[model samples]
Target: MSLRVTFLGTGGAVPTTERAPSAIFVNREGDRLLFDCGEGTQREMMRAGTGFGIDHLFVSHLHGDHVLGIPGLVQTLGFNDRTDPLRVHCPPGTGDDLHDLVHAVGHQPGFPVRIEEVGPGDVALSADGYEVRAFETTHRTVSQGYVLEEADRPGRFDRPRAEELGVPVGPAFGRLHSGESVELEDGTVVESDQVVGPPRPGRKLVYTADTRPRERTVEVAEDADLLVHDATFADDMADRAR
Candidate 1:
C-alpha cells in the first residue's frame, strides 16, 4: 500500500507566502482524505496537483481558520462532475455551520453532501483497509482529533506456488491469497498455508488540530508513522493554553 501526505497549508491563524493555512491532504493508497481545510486550501491543492479526488473531509472544529476552504473544495468537486457522495466529519452540534458551507457554492452539488458531527470514541469512517477514529482533544473551542488506523493485512500470497499447483488466476486466486482453502478442478485440496503468509501491521497517521497537549493524544499517537499537530504557542505559553 502506498500512502502520501502533502501539507497544503502549515500556518496557524494567519497566511503568508511561505504557508497558506491549516490543511493536510493525505493519499492513502489512492483514497484521498483532507484534514482541516483552512482558507485558500483549494488553491494550495491545485498547486500541489492534488486533484478533486477527495471523497472525505475531516474537520477538527468549526473555527473559521480551521474550515474556511470547504466551499471551494465542494464547488470544485461539483464542477468536475463528482457524483459520489462527499462526507464531512466535524464536532457535534455544528449542523448550522455545515449547512451554510453546503449552500455557499451558489448551486447545490450534483452529489449528496453528508455531514456528520463526530466526537470522542466515535468511528467516523471504517473501511476494509483503514478506520478513522476520533479522540477527545482540548482547545479554545470544542474540538476532536483524528487517528488513521490501518487494518492488519493478510499474510503474503504465494503466487508462484499457486500457479504451480494448477490453480487458475483471478477470483479463486484472490480467495486463496486471503487464506481461503480452494479445491482445484483435479479434486486436489489446496490449503491456505500453501499460499498465505502471516499477519502484517499497517501504518498509522494522527492529526490533532489546535489543542493543548493531553494524554489522550499521546495514547492515540503512540508509535504513529506520521503525526501532524498544532503547536500554536511556544513552551512559555503552555500555562496559558491550559
Candidate 2:
C-alpha cells in the first residue's frame, strides 16, 4: 500500500489566507492520522478532503494554536454520531489539558476520547504493519516530532516455479516460504533460498514539529521518504524563530 501525506494547515502561530495552522494528515492503508491539530484544523481537514473520524492525533506542543481545536473537533465528532474511539498523544500533562478542555466544553457524552501523555521513545500508534515513534524536540516548552514507518515484509516465494517442478501446494510450500528445507513426498528436497526473492525494504516518514534547528531533528529525518520541518519564518528571521 502507498503512504500519502496531505498538509491540512501549514502556517505557524498565525493563520494565513493560504495556510491555516500546524496540522497534517498522513494516510496509510486507509488510516488517517492527524499531526498537530492547530486552530481551524477541522475546517482545514474538510477543505483537504480528509474525512472526519481521525483515529489518532499527535500534538507537537501545548501552544494554543496547536491544540485549540481539540474541543471543537471532539464535539463535532459527537454531533455527527461517530462511535469510534479517538486517541490523542502529546507530552506529559497533555491529559490534564484535554480534560480541562472537555470540562470547559460541558462534557459532551457518548464520544470516548483517550488522552495519552508521551515522551521520547514512545510508540504513538502501531498496527497493520506500521508504527509511529515520538521523539522529543527542542522548543520553549515540551514538544515532540514523529516518525512513521512500515514494518518489513517477508520476501515473496516463487510459487509458480515450484509448481512447475511438480511441487504440491501444501505444507511443503509453507516450509519453502519460511526459509526452511522441505522434502517432497517423492523424496525431492527444496530449499527456501532458491524460491524466495529479496526481502522488501520498509518505508519511513518523519515530521519535525515546532522547534529550533537541532542535530536530533536531522537524525530523526535521516533517509526518510518525507521530511517535514517547521519553517515559520524566512531565512532572515531564523534567529528570531529560534
Candidate 3:
C-alpha cells in the first residue's frame, strides 16, 4: 500500500498569497486523514484535488489559524449533499469549541459530525490497519500531537521454499503465508516459519503542528517514516521564539 502526503498549506498563522494556513493531507492505502484544518483549507483541498472525503480530521489546537476552516468545510459538504458522518478529533477541553464552530455557519450539515476529545497518551482513532495516538505538545494552547502507526505486516513468503517442502500451490500456500501450519497430502506438517521471513516494521508518520520542540515529540517520532513538525521560527531566533 502506497502512502501519500499532500502539503495543502504550510504558511504560518497568517496566510500569504503563496500559501494558505496549516493543513496536511495524508492518504495511506486510500484511508484519507486531514491534520489541522487551517484557514482556507477547503479551498486548498479543492486546488489539490484531494476532495472533501476525509475519513477523519485531527486538530492540534484551538487556534484560529489551525481550526478556522471547520465551518466552511462542513457547509461545503452540506452543499455537496454528503451523508457520511465526519469525525473530528481535537485536544481535550476543545471539543465544545469545535462543536460550536461546526454549527457557527447558522446551519447544520446533512451529515453527522462527531467531536472526539483526545488527551496525551490516548489512542484517538483506531482503523483497520493503523492507529492514531496522541502525544503531549508544548504550545500556547492546550495542544497535542499525533502519531499514525500501522500494524506490523507479515513477512515475505518464500514460495519456492514452500513448494520445495511439498506444500501444494493452493490454499495451503495462503495458510503458510498467514503464519499457519498446514498438513500436506503425505501428512507432513509445514511450519510457517520455514517459508516466511521475519515480520517487517510498518510505516509510521508523526505530526506535531505548531508545537515547540518537546520530548514527547521525539519519543513518538522514534523510527518514524515521516515526522512533520512545526518550524514557525528559524533556529537563529530560538531565544526570541521562546
Candidate 4:
C-alpha cells in the first residue's frame, strides 16, 4: 500500500482567505487519518474529494482555530448518517476541551465518539494495521506531534527456488518461510533463508502542526515520504512565531 499526504491548512492561529489553520490529511491505503482539524478542515476535505466519516483525528493543541471545527465536523458526519466510530488523540487537556465544546454544542451523546489523551509515548490503536506514536513538541501548550504507520506486509516468496530443489508445497512451506528447516517427503530439508526476501518496511507519515523549528522535528521526519510542517510566517518572522 502507498501513503499520500494532503495539506488542508497551513496558516497560523488566524484563518485567512488564502490560508486556513494547521490541518493535514494522511491517506494510508484508503483510510483518512486527519491531523489537526483546524477551521474549514471539513470543507477542505470536501473540496479535496475526501468523503466524510473520519475515524481518526489527531490534534496538537487546544487553540481555537486548531480545534474549533472539531465538534462541527463530527456533527456533520453524524448528520450524514455516518456511524463509524471516531477516535481522537490529543494532549492532556484535550479531553476536557472536547467535552466542554460538545456540551456547548448540545451533543446528544448518541454519536460514536472516543477521546483519548496521549503523551510522549507509543499509542497502540489496533493490531490490524494502524498505529500512532505521540511525541512532545515545544509549543505554548502541552503540544504533541504524531507518527501514523501501517503494519503487516506480505512480500514475495520464491516458490520456484523451492520447486527447483524438489521441495513439496505444504505446511512445511509455511514453516520454511518462517525461518525454520522443514523436512520434505524424501528426507530433503528446506531452509527459510533460501526462499524468502527481507521483510518490507511499513509506510510512515509525520505531521508537525505548529512549532518553532526544533531538531526533534527533523529527526522525526527523517526519510519520511511526507513531512507536513507549518510555515505560518516567512523566515523573517522566526522570532514572532517562536
Candidate 5:
C-alpha cells in the first residue's frame, strides 16, 4: 500500500502570497482525504494535481482559515460534474454551522453533502484497512485533532522455513501467510505461526490544527509517522501562544 501526504496550504490565520491557509491532502492506497479546507484550497489542489476525487473532509475547527474554502470546493466539485457524495467530518455541535457553510451561496451542489459531528475519543471515519480517530486539543473554541491509523498487518512470511517443513510453494503458502493452518498431502497440519512472524504495526499520522501545546497531543502523537500541529507563533511569543 502506498501512503503519501501533500501540504496543499500551510499559512497562518492571515494568508500571504507565499502561502495559502491550512489544508492537507493525504493519499493512502489511493483513498484521498482532506484534513482542512482553507481559502484557495481548491487552487492549491489543482496546482498540486491532487484531483477532486476526495470523498472525505476532516475539519479541526470552524475558523475561517481552517474551513472557509468548503463552499468554493463544493462548487468546484459540482462544476466538475461530481456525482459522488461528500462526507465532512467536524467537531461536535458544529455540524449545522458547517452545513450552512457548504450552502453559503444559498444553493446546494448537485452531489450529496453530509456533515458528521465527531467528538474527542470518537471514531471520525472508518475505512477498509484503517480508522480516523478524534482527540481533544487545547483551542479557543470547540476544536479537536485527528489520527489516521491503519490496521495491524500480518507478519512476514517465512518461505525457507515453510519449504523446510514440507510445505509446498502453492496455495498453502498463501493460506499460512494469512494466518490459516494448512494440511499437507500427507495429513500433516502446518500452523501459520510456524512460518509467520509476529504481527507488525501499521502507519499512523496525526493532525492538530490551531491548538496550543498540550500533553494530550503528545500522548496521541506517540509513535506517529507524521505529526502536523499548529506552530504559527514564534518561540519569543510562547507566553502569548499559550
Candidate 6:
C-alpha cells in the first residue's frame, strides 16, 4: 500500500530559479509514472533525487513548458541501457507528432518508446492494482488530465467469526484478512468471506496539468486524496488563460 507523488516542476511557460515547469512523479507500489515532462525536467528529477527509470510519461499538451523534456529523458534512458519500452501518453490527435518528437533526437533509443494519444474517459494505463483515467480540460489548445486510482482492498477481518470457527488468532487471521481460506488445527475450514467483509475503499489522486478552472476538473477530482491544480496566474490574469 504505497503511493508517492512528487511535483518536479510547478511553474508555467517561463521556469524560474524556484519552480521548474509542469512535471509530476508518481510511484505507486514501484510503478514509476511521470506526468508532463517540462523543460529541464530530467535535471529537476536528478536534483530532487527521483529515479530515472520511469515506465510511463503522460503529456497534457504540446506546450513547450509541458513537453520540452522528451528528447533528453529518452536519451538519458538510452544511455543508462534501459531495455523496457517507455510508454508516452498524450491528448487526442497528437500520437504522430509525439512519435516524430521522440525520434527527432537523431538515433533510435535502446528501448522502445510507445506513444499513445488519448481523450476523455480513456484508460491511459491499467495494471493489476491501479488504473489511470484521462479527462478533458479547457485550455487554449487541447489538453487532458489524469486520475490515479487504486483497487479496493479487502475489508476488516472478522475476528469473532474466525475464533467462533476455531481458527487461531495469529497467522491464520492474517491469511483470512488477505482473502485466503484457512484451516484450523481441528481441520475446520474457514472461508475468507466468513472472516472478512466487503472490499473497502481505495485512494485517488488527480493531476490537472494546466487549464482554466473548469467543471471537468471538479467532476474528475471529487473526493480525491490529493488534487494538484494549475495556479499559473492571479484572478486579474484569468482572461489570458482562456
Best by lDDT: 5
**Candidate 5: clashing pairs of residues:** none
Model 5 bad stretches (over 4 Å): 163-166
Predict model 4's lDDT versus the native: 0.76
Per-candidate alpha-carbon RMSD to the true structure:
2.7, 2.7, 1.6, 3.2, 1.7, 2.5
lDDT of 1: 0.88
TM-score of each: 0.86, 0.85, 0.93, 0.81, 0.93, 0.89
> For each candidate, what is the lDDT?
0.88, 0.83, 0.91, 0.76, 0.94, 0.88
TM-score of model number 3:
0.93
lDDT of 6 at 193: 93
Residue by residue across 1-242, what tens digits does model 2's lDDT show? Answer: 86889998888788989888888898888898999888798898788788887899888888877888777788788889988888888887677876776555476647777888887888988889999999988888888899998887768889898887677888888888878887777898877877888888789988887888889888888878888988777799877765
Query: For candidate 4, lDDT tens digit of each residue in 69-95?
Result: 787787778788876788888787678
Regions of candidate 4 where Cα sits further than 4 Å from its true position: 124-126, 150-155, 158-191
| lDDT accuracy of residue 209 in candidate 4 | 78
lDDT of 1 by residue, 61-109 (tens): 8888888888877888889988899888988888678879878946587
Candidates ranked by lDDT, best first?
Answer: 5, 3, 6, 1, 2, 4
Candidate 2 residue pairs that clash: none
Quote the lDDT for 36 in model 1. Answer: 89
For candidate 5, the per-residue lDDT at 188 reads 96
Q: Is candidate 4 or candidate 6 better by TM-score?
A: 6
3 versus 6: better lDDT goes to: 3
Query: What's the candidate order when arranged by decreasing TM-score?
Result: 3, 5, 6, 1, 2, 4
